[model samples]
Target: MAREKRTEQLFVTVPSFFRCPISMDVMKSPVSLCTGVTYDRSSIEKWLALGHNTCPATMQTLPSTNTTPNLTLRRLIHLWISQADITPAISKQEAADVINGEFDSNSLTKMIGFINSSEENLKFVALSNHAVPKLVEAFAKSDSMRVLELIVEVLDLISMENAVREKLNELILKSDGITDYLSSFNLVLQKGNTESKVKSARILELMAVNSDSQRKIAEKAGLLHELYSLCSVETETSAVEAGLSALLAISTSRSVKKELIRFGMVKTVGKILSGYDYSSAVRAVIEKSLKMLEMVATCTEGRGAISEDRECVVEIVKRLMKCSRAATEHGITVLWSVCCLARDGTAQENVAKVNGFTRVLLVMQSDCSSNTRLMCGELVKVLREKNMKSNLAPYETKTTHITPY
Candidate 1:
């Protein structure tokens, strides 16, 4: 009863045939029990595994537990997904004009459909017509969250083109049409639901790969701060992963690292890492945050921010035990950055104080990648040199100047 109520709340008209009798989601691999009611294959499998001989939908006892696939329903679902674009088509000239900034609602709608069509011919023509600027323009003018989300989806598709990326880079530098789109995306982060926010962050992640986009996003550091806030508040793992990915991409620009530091990203990420239980859903977040922290720590300000939080360093050191080579490499790289670049003494002191040196040495001797081994060796050398210098400092003082304690 509760599941039925929740399903009704989530969708207005899910065709009864499209839904699984057990789970209620659209059936991916529908199967039928002897009792004649259909359920998703996995759902019914679990039902039978639990010794259930009754049909969930009809409450009738089944004579046999054997299942049969509903191929007709599966084929119907495939056709529906393929023909899901209900938008009307437009002429190439109309799409061209829309890309050129003409802004007809009908034409824009058709262009969105064309992009969604995923036909190589449509993709080529869209790129040939130069779509990035007008897409941003359309996105900026959109008042509806649904429209904004559609524009972002189209933008994500076109951003893959080299020409589109170059044009986007120029626009970001000039704060032209791109900035308006960015402003709207910031609003999405603030007001849109979890799905829209996830889509927006993913679009920004793709854009941030371009150096100009990174600089442009850093200029609006408040958006990055909002992403951090989203990471902290979102219960959905995918949303948090998207948020972290966007930050990671933005941190790739040398100019953007300080903004991340200013937002206290290291501490924010550390808090997430500390609470996460090991699951497939959270593994991506853990890997992404470690990589982003590595990039951020390359800058002096970032090193200072991370070093200020003792637990951040400790958390990073803890990751050396993880089986992921990428995670371990990033973790060590951040430690190396703090030890080598931070002018403040706290970063190095914390490394020694936390016994991080031992972990680095242990990983150095393991069967890890060459890069990890090399980073560990470099860190060990630095720690040894710092230790030697500290030990020799007392001996360098003049004997005559020494006073009895």
Candidate 2:
């Protein structure tokens, strides 16, 4: 009986290294920082997301926040779990009970683990078992940031299903639902760390499916400003993309577009376009930035901003036919809005100075869309008309026949 008791104690007590210092839970995905301290990926990510620059375990100042996966440690944890006969799966009823009952960190962690597990059967079971509504109830009632983060993470996972996503949208947009969560979301955006902010922004983007929701989301106090701040070149690429994507979802409203300009969005996008190295930067970010620039340029204020900033205009000209086809189209649209539609002479001159005539001709010759070809034709006409007296030889007009489309 004494021997049996010792075995029981051994099974109950987890090794210190096997647990994350922040959460004290067995590390699901272990990673190490520059200080050589290992932690669970989720916990350490949350710690860094909160803007802490030091190692959590040693409290030592960190040289870098990058985490390397501790593969050997992860393997050991898996082996220990197997040897100890530990099963992480919870029954469907148990999942509903835990979610409906008081917030328990351990139980929530298990649910997250179960949902994120490799077993396809378990994932289907969790979702089929009324997990979405129960979790949404917890999401609405819980005021704890930690609880919100965990719940949001789970919701984000569950949101992959079309049915679950539609249900979540309904719950989020119901009367007073948007109002109640907007405050909480605002708090998260203001004080919660990077990871939390990204998740909240994603949820906001998903919820803004229609004009009413889009307008409401944009009108949220300080929401646009916070999202605008995330578009900085200094921010992580993922965060920047998330911010741009969310803004794009709501930018259909003319008022929202104007508000974004008032927030200095044009200048921010110009800085990102001019400062970021295209080769190293993510393609999606470039496309999104250019797309956002084009959207703002449709309005009077946006066109003025783009045309006034000579560097921004030049940068837009430089990206012609250089990035993806979508980016090229966006770039062309911005130039068209400022030079052709708005008829900004400075923008016209900027295009000519950058040898844009030749670039436009090259795009015209390529298999571009009909609308893009028309824009190029107009751009060529404007550039030629503006620089009629100057030596047109530099623009290679004599060598390449300007196709009159």
Candidate 3:
């Protein structure tokens, strides 16, 4: 007799539950996971051990686990083997076409390319009238940011239906949604198209609403400087307001605020007083910038004491005094901080730089805003107490508070 080769038969290949039917890729979580292939070897063994033969794949309801031996049982076994061979490449496309073209479930593939490569374009082109559940599975498994941007627009174009927007939002949340694009966000905002700018602003503001860590990630990703420049310069009031709001968020973050200061933002603040056309907005920024400056002034690590910073403040105050009355509430604030710090560090001679502090005394005496007036009064009191020949405001007992915001 010929020697018989001894070999073991192979077990069925059962894949993980996440494999996409369309693309055959492993699934990313938080998507539609289909239930299919299982690996309960114990269950299969239990079914077979009873000896009434049956195919587990068919899951047919039958009476006996053991069978009387016959060619019919052999034929059934042959059919089972044939079906197993067909399953991997089986009628999948026909199934996809049926759902996508008939049910309208499968969305168009989102376009993603350089410039034209956005997600919305692809979604439009690939969208079908039918429900391609597998194609949606394909999208879920292979998420690309380019696809999501497209979906956002597609949702909007389809009248922003709740289901679509919610779906898009889910996609966004899953992708952690482009929080790093903050580096280019302002350039997007500065585009000539008003609608585009508004949309960009809204997108950025929404990201800011996430947790403190998410917000910090956005700032580190480059939002702080871009928004700071836009807040003072954008012609559109809405854009400016939005930028200011972004700045406020940035200021609230201690670490982010420190980063902004280290990035040479102090000079940027110093420059805002003159270049911006909206005096009201400009003044608001001037006040904000000074508040930041005072914090810097109090910092212990510096060669200039408060005095060097005071010189910069004196210069701005002198410039404002030329058309000083036209300055907004925030402008007076810069003056107030300047004068307050000057009182702490300056002498009789440097006060000569702006008319011997006489002009500052005048702003204190006559300015209508109570904070400005009080800050102005405090400067005079400091000067008198320091023995400077300043016949400024007679120091008032009631004007105890000197800081201006």
The numbered model that scores best in TM-score is 2
**lDDT by residue (tens digit), candidate 3, 1-405:** 111111001111323232222112122211211122222232334345666343333222335443332333335434544554422211334434443442221222211111122224324333433222333343344334333333222222331223433343343433453342332344444432433343444444444444653455344544566665565456654454445555554454446556555655455545544444433324434444445544444333211332444455554555443332434234344444444644445533344444534555656655557877776666556555544454444434442332221
Q: What TM-score should be assigned to candidate 1?
A: 0.63
Ranking by lDDT: 2, 1, 3
Candidate that beats the other on lDDT, 1 or 3, i.e. the better one: 1
TM-score of each: 0.63, 0.73, 0.40
Specify the poorest-scoring 10-residue window by lDDT in model 3: 1-10
Provide the overall lDDT of each model, using Cα atoms, as 2-decimal numbers. Answer: 0.67, 0.74, 0.40
Question: What ranges in model 1 sit over 4 Å off?
Answer: 1-114, 121-125, 128-133, 170-175, 252-255, 339-358, 369-371, 378-405
Task: Give the count of colliding residue pairs in each prediction.
Answer: 0, 0, 30
Find the 10 residues in a row with the least total lDDT in model 1.
396-405
Question: For model 1, how does the per-residue alpha-carbon lDDT over 288-333 read when each residue is reduced to its tens digit?
Answer: 7788788887777777788888888878876775525556778888
Off by over 4 Å in 2: 1-93, 119-130, 389-393, 397-405
- Which pairs of residues collide in model 1? none
Q: What lDDT is reached at residue 333 by model 3?
A: 49
lDDT of 2 at 231: 75
Deviation from truth (RMSD, Å), model 1:
14.2
